[model samples]
Target: MTNDRRVIVHPDKPALASSVAARFLTKVVDLLDERPVVHIVLTGGSIANAVLEQVAQSSARDTIDWQRIHLWWGDERWVPLGDAERNEGQAHAALIDAIDIPEANVHAMPASDGGLTLDEAAEAYARELALHAPEGADTPVFDITFLGVGPDGHIASLFPHRSGIQVTDATVIPVRNSPKPPPERLSLTRPVLNASDRIWLVLAGADKASALGLALAGASRDEVPVAGIKGRRRTVFFVDREAAAEVPERLISPDY
Candidate 1:
């Protein structure tokens, strides 16, 4: 959040997710209508899962050719494919399970069985993007990247006061000793995140108030990972009332 930017807050997580999903679908349809394919980077967490569920329930969902849509993860816990805790597994339960997206189009990071080291996984994901992305496209090449704001003001695996922010080369990196659980994880660095056409940050819960307030108050980038988002009009935040209670009235949406 910046002094010049506006925040869109809803009364609850469900409402926030539903509203954002509706808007996201419109963009998806427009992209497909103009091009042969659409690419998106997905994230994990409860709010994101809710958004995906809403997407699955949307009437316009079936209008898009699912097979023409390419999918990639913004981060992942280093675990077996389909493992209960894996972000890919959670996404499958929410949206992918209900869609006809092709297996080849869904690109996930190397699981434990991929026979690649953490560094290798990072390189492999980058190669995957290079193969499918349009010519001259930037690092990420994602049409839309969905993210979740952690209670600590972290986005993806970029934790506050952590070294993930300085990553410049590899779009993906293996994270060890994450302040959150599942220490061994892989995440999309800010370089890749900033290259996206659009970024939607979905945050909820009262526990996130202080961090949200700090983030919106122009906190230092190293202290609040959310500050890494450079929208220029391409970024938006979806927050529930409880999560925004600490924020000033001017920052909260009137509709909420």
Candidate 2:
């Protein structure tokens, strides 16, 4: 794997969502030609949800085998199963609900109402990940990992300057007293996220311009978490023009 990095700038939020969604579908179709199963780590954010909605509506979605695609979250708020604030819930409404995938294929993190404490849920998800791990690996090899970058440069639940950002001992880490809402969350550690074959980091808005610039400029991982992510094969920053303010013209790729 080359560990290649690229910047894809779209015209606006809608363009970013639709382009990424179409790319996702085509990638899945191509992967199915090489393997029987494909695991994708998904993230949450308005832009991410928009992309999922695009995936749901695109007729091109029917080109791949839905059952072979396993959806995993990069991080999840420890809210109840169907809570409106839960990432899984948003994903369900945006894409999963309209698809014919099996319940077993959707690997959602535990809910607070599921009788498991936050720590318990984290450990349980870790065990589940290990169960699906390849023979010599501790975590499953994700084919494509979709992540949404926060305006502050956070990826998943790993906020800048947070202690959780340094944790590599666990595949899934429990985040507490988070700067973002809901306070508690379960997130796949950076190693897991970085281990994916392809990483798609997306952002949309002027608020994200600073973070996006720092990330592409190779800022400190502790200060800008998104900067640390590097996929085994390809790592791409998919941003709308508003968020691409500081991106170098040379890095602005015209196509994938």
Candidate 3:
């Protein structure tokens, strides 16, 4: 990993999730000590869900004020409100429902049945971001943004060689024809994601090795969307040995 980026390789998936959960709790607790509320952007995937579960099981989980935490999604499937495949739904099942966060504090992207067109939903989410954003900023300065990388090197809904990856003006946009299932989705644009103070990419599995390697090797954003992501303060990739298999030895740190 470069000076601006760091990689933490765990022995296995369970270990990776546990370590990330512990660090996440620490970060939230530390930030809450200095501020009234802490904002976080969450992602969806097997490993992402695993981390959430770990957080829920943590002994320190109750120390942080859940009601003072604001939750947001980095991306969401444009499905019905409670669809099984929807990221927001899965998140609620895995963590939200187990916590005390107020309904107003949970900012989920609009669902398809919300009486808004896909474009309209995107616009609405952008407006929401603008409303919560810090003064003089187009997006919120999230305390931390958690994301999961696709095997295709995509981050959020920005796929390689896609229009989402090329967009430069919008903070949120509607995505169509995603290489993965549920083609239609809503995702925060690169600028909005980069507005965060820190970004944590939680990844696992051998299938992701090639993409992880390419991203760490400085692949272009247009070719590897994950490569384009950088936080204002720090960017860290938490991966298990299987996922880090293809990354250079110099970039893989076992210290975590």
Question: How high a TM-score does candidate 2 get?
Answer: 0.98
Candidate 2: count of backbone clashes, pairs at least 3 residues apart or interchain: 0
Per-residue lDDT tens digits for candidate 3, residues 86-134, read 9999899888998988999999999999999999999999999889887
Write one digit per residue (lDDT tens) for candidate 1, span 112-229. Answer: 6678887788788878877875687535367888888888888888898889977887777888899898788889888788777778788899988888888878888789888777
Give Cα distance to truth, residue 138, candidate 3, Å: 1.7
Candidate of highest TM-score? 2
Provide the overall lDDT of each model, using Cα atoms, as 2-decimal numbers.
Answer: 0.82, 0.91, 0.91
Superposed model 3: Cα runs more than 4 Å off? 1-3
Q: TM-score for each prediction?
A: 0.92, 0.98, 0.97
As for candidate 1, its clashing pairs are none
TM-score of model 1 (CA atoms): 0.92
Model 1 poorest 10 in a row by lDDT: 1-10
Please give the RMSD to the true structure for each candidate, in Å.
2.1, 1.1, 1.5
Error of 2 at 92 (Å): 0.3
